[model samples]
Target: MSVINRVLRDLDQRQQQQSKGSYTPAAMAPQPLHWTWMIGIAVGTAVVIVILLNLYWWLTIDTDPALQVVEAPVTNQPTVIAATAEESADQAVEEVERGTDAESASKPALQRGPVKPRELVQVPPSPTESRTSELEEAEATTEPVVSEIPTETLATVAPEPEAEVEATDTPSTFAVERVQLSPNELAETNLQKARSALRRGEREQGQELLEKALTVMPEHVAVRSELAAYWYGRGFATRAVAILQQGLDRVPQQSQWQLLLGRILERMGRIEDAYIALQSVDSSSAEYIDLLEVRGNAANQLGYFSEAAQDFLALASLKSEGRWWLAAAVAFEDAGEPAAALRAYRQAAFARDLGVDARRYAEDRLQALGGS
Candidate 1:
């Protein structure tokens, strides 16, 4: 059994050795890629990279050569279209020096070609170069330069005779003429001046102006009213009344005149005259409140208790004052209207703004009238 095992082991060792000998190693395998092929590939990739880099550079480069050049002239310098007179003179001098002025000038003028338009160009010449170019231009034209007119042309162009404008005595359209005022307008003007003078304390001047206004138009209500107001303020009540009456005689429908007259008469203690003057005053007059107050007092003084009560009630209706209510109650009591008097007394006694004496009087009146 041992001998057989040794033979089998020997056979296994021989089989292993034959298998090892039959298999080829990686280092001994056939090479698919050579160094030359790798070198060639590397070279081609490098060339391709260089070409791409160059192509990118060409595309990204700024190729405008004019943008690199500095602007020769200031941007603000005015463009020089034609040469100046001095340049023309210099050109003329040079042409005379050349001895063939007509032939040379005519030749250049005939040989010159049409000018072509150029873009993205800056041809601003130096001062000396400009002068030279002007001289060349002068030599190239046989006709007179822009700055000089030939003697023949000047002689051919005669001066036109100027027309003479004759001076005439014509009235100016804008001259201010004196405006002629009518008598009424003149009176109004004087009245305004009188009022202004009175406001300034020029009493004598104001009176004179007022008189002048009345003289111009005696029927002038406004002038008469102003004069009456002035006289009334100056303590000349009779004169003021006289002036207002004169206005009323002429313009009887003027309610303001009547109001002023009534106020003056009432102040002068002429109660009957005041009542008559105020009777004609319209309820819509601006002096209606004054009329109510003065007429009411006048009526009460003259024993016209019913009219006085009506006036006081109207005033109460207008202002809702406790004093007015009390006045209304007293007038109603005197006029024999106990019901209205009692109601008015109650209102006065309970009034929000009643005076102490007024409220006490209202309470006594209410108690007398048997009101709660």
Candidate 2:
């Protein structure tokens, strides 16, 4: 019985020792990995991936400047393009001219129309007509080439200014049709023709041309003067008067015309009419001296002694001649102004250029007026 009990005790002791060796404490047990270690591992993996990608890109990229592409610079100007187009058009025109010359040489039998010059074309082959013919011929031979030109280029090359162009519809080819003469110009031409006719002794033709000139331009001073002189020299005083009056009526501002009219009226004994006509003469006129003399004479004839004296005094101041002073004295005496007449007589009596008869007349007037 003691031996069996001792064997049970040994077996129990062996089991207790085995249980103590297998059992682990909770504080000493192996725990799951921390989240911080997991986060650190993930970040390290991303950094390694980025480094590998950069190394791959560096290895694949090209580093040579020689293989780089180049592009042309851009411009916004339309004139530059137009200049290029003009150069192209010049080349095209030269080619067209060469072809036309070749065709003419090759087919002498082909009756080609005469090639009108592009510079100046007239008559039936008017400038525009010539241009159209040229364009049509050029298009027939080189339509594809010309068609490549821009519409702007075509517009630039086709039309011309009207002044430089000639018309073909009119039957007459007179140069007068091309040029339009102004009224003054026509009158001038007529005046020249009349002078030529007069020189050639063609009286009727000269008269006709002069009349035609006046009809064309009533205010033509040269033409009117020429016609008036022509009649007055031919002893037709009335005709000269009419022509000059007609000119004055059209251009009253013409001082030369006024002077001529006054002279003609005075010559015809129309003193009153002549004085009135001469009143409009400008003081700045080349005919001013002539105007004063004629007006003074006409004034005396019309009993306007004061006006005559004033006109003669102006003439004396300008001419410094004793005859003018004597005339002024006579005018002043007629005007009933003895003081002014005496002063004028004194000037005339001692004048150096006064004629013998004039100086004696002045002295006699001075004595009669109670002056020394």
Candidate 3:
């Protein structure tokens, strides 16, 4: 029995040893980390950072209602009235070196607001009133001003006083000293820098440079126009008007400056002043079309639809845009000239530059007036 037990145990041990020897464990190998996936993750992170930075830069200049311009006031700049003719001469020399165009009329994207028809005062005074003085007669003989805007609109356009502001306190921190610096060169450099900054979307920096330029040369027409254009594009027509008005003080007969001022006044619904400014422009000037547009807008705002229609028709003759024709047709309709309106509408429908909505308007007007 002892011999049989030993034999059975040996048989079991031999079988276990055979199984262990046959199944030699394969050597374990470590799997490599996915470097390609890690690279993809790093690239995606970089792209996200770039996008975030760009968005931040763009939003920095956004004039949200909650944000206000909080620039530090420059303490050392000379008063605009105190600015000497020598400084102006220096700036003019600088501009000449830079080859800046004196008549550069590059307009920015204009800001627009609601302009409703206002009641006009009488143009001619009644002779039977009383034995008034000559002064009274002259005052009464002045052309009627278009100034019956709603109270709310008037309130929104207040706070201009630009020349007053310049004379009292300049708005920026980087002030220039009249006696301590390289006058014209400094101003030119600043203006060039301002243009560069604006092109790069650095609005505040550009604005600061412009303020510096104006400090050195308050009546610098190009600098004033550029600065005014910036404000005008930002919906501050009063600010633009004030700046340009200051420019007009220096060069009262400057046609380009007057044209821009007229355009701004029209946008502000100062129809009478705008019309007068437009009338001052020569008909043979290069800006004839712009003058027409400005005069037409002013006339339209003052409820002179017949005059507006005539101006628009002249504008249509200059440029074959459907929008102009459409505007002319609407003005004609307002003037109670259905035939003229229908002719303009038909012309508008066939223009290649015709917008979908403008086309629809022309068709509808034509249908209503019983025209093809």
How do the residues 1-372 of candidate 3 rate in per-residue lDDT, one tens digit apiece? 999999999999999999988987688688877999899999999999998886674344221211223344677543232223355445445544332232123322222223222222122223443234334545645667897899999888878589877866855577776665565667777889999999999999999999899899876667888899989988888888888888877767566777889977876778798887665556777777887888898889889999899999989988988888999999999999999999999999988899898899899989999996
Worst ten-residue run, lDDT, model 2?
Answer: 60-69
lDDT of 2 by residue, 102-205 (tens): 65586553344343333211123456865776666555545244347787887889765564465433456556457889999999999999999999999889
How well does each candidate superpose onto the true structure, as a TM-score? Answer: 0.51, 0.50, 0.39
In model 2, the runs with Cα more than 4 Å from the true position are 1-177
Decreasing TM-score order of the candidates: 1, 2, 3
| Number of backbone-clashing residue pairs for each candidate, in the order shown | 0, 0, 0
Model 2 scores a C-alpha lDDT of 0.79
Backbone clash pairs for candidate 3 read none
| Candidate 1 regions with alpha-carbon error over 4 angstroms | 1-178, 182-184, 218-221
Model 3 lDDT, residue 351, Cα: 88
Supply the TM-score for candidate 2: 0.50
**Cα lDDT for residue 38, model 3?**
91
